[model samples]
Target: MFLEREEYAILRSHVHADSVDLVDALAATGLRWSEMAALPPRDLTLHGSRPMLRVQRAWKRIDGGKALGAPKTKRSRRTLVLSPYLVQPFKRNCAGKQPNDFVFTAPEGGAWDSGGFYHAWTRAVSTMRVGRPRSPPRPVTASPNDRVSTTSVTRPQSHDLSHTHASWLIAKKVPLPGIQARLGHESITTTVDRYGHPLAMLDDEIIEAIEWSMNPMAA
Candidate 1:
């Protein structure tokens, strides 16, 4: 379905098992299409108590094809931790593969290409009847935006998992500097640019704590 959060949840609740895996990897990891496609098997590692992806090289666009390149930005070359939910599927898929093997490969053992992935994704989304386009928000953008129409809302690219993860971290009040490192941003600024401060979920907590400390009588 289109990239809207509600639509995504709905789709997740009902999509086929294979499609669900694809969606989970995309939405939870926030990896770009190419990065996801080019993920090497060796990137998967065991973290504190979970599996993590050691991001290093990324796939770059080349002469009418794709080639290996440095990570997206200097900051993008870092490790990414994943929950057991994610690691289980990975282990199952990686059964006998070598470390140099692509993390997500085609049946022929070739690397994943976004073009093919997109085609498959679109078909899956369509089958699920998710994020169908409707009347445009504005007349001007309607034509371009409604390129794909269904009965529900529009779907977004899977890379939005990065934003989702960032938002979740912010909402949980996770430490900022740590997040910056996890996402491999050159600077916290880069992370902030892509993921703005989480909506102020801490206002009540901060206010209550201040009030309690100020009024000894309440304590």
Candidate 2:
């Protein structure tokens, strides 16, 4: 599931200072976690009229360690445009790094493993109370009724941010093809199948047009 704007803000506020840029980059670009982890400074195009992130390789976990390899699919190796707001975070991340150096590295200057990234994300989200606690039917207990509490906390995987980004684009009415290209989906059908629900936002407008067509006098 995708994060709402306020929840996203809360999550961002709680990210560790060292990982702020990494989290920001994920939210901004919607790159897969592996892609983000393997991004190099050279992949960033911050100077040109169209700033973008060049997706090349991803960090893949092997038997004993990790390796940088081509993206999951050829389409996944496409370039994505960056919003102006995202440029500074990328710039901050690129500073003092060589072109070949990874843009977002671990504290020890290695590719960030999935485990470490998950830990950092958990630490950031643990601070906030996400949703209301549900009161389950009082457990049948021998003693006085103890409340069975269940809170709906939003524990989004790092990849969910990519979903969030696509949701935002869909909410803003970006075209399916554009979204497909930005997400590097090999087929427009993939993008549509994944996010077509958001297009329901047009339901009311469609209904209005149909009504107008049925009764010209109403117009």
lDDT on C-alpha atoms for all candidate structures: 0.69, 0.83
Error of 2 at 63 (Å): 3.7
Highest TM-score: give the candidate number.
2
In model 1, the number of clashes is 12
Over the stretch 40-150, how does candidate 2's per-residue lDDT look in tens digits?
A: 999999987899889999977789888989998988989988899989888987899999898888876677778888998888878865544445556566356554557
Look at candidate 2 and give me any clashing residue pairs. none
Off by over 4 Å in 1: 1-7, 13-16, 46-48, 107-109, 127-153, 209-219
Cand. 2 TM to true fold = 0.83
Report residue 172 deviation for candidate 2 (angstroms): 0.3
RMSD of every candidate to native, in Å, equals 5.3, 4.2
Shift in Å, residue 122, candidate 1: 2.1
Clashes of each: 12, 0
lDDT leader:
2
Model 1 weakest lDDT span, ten residues long: 144-153
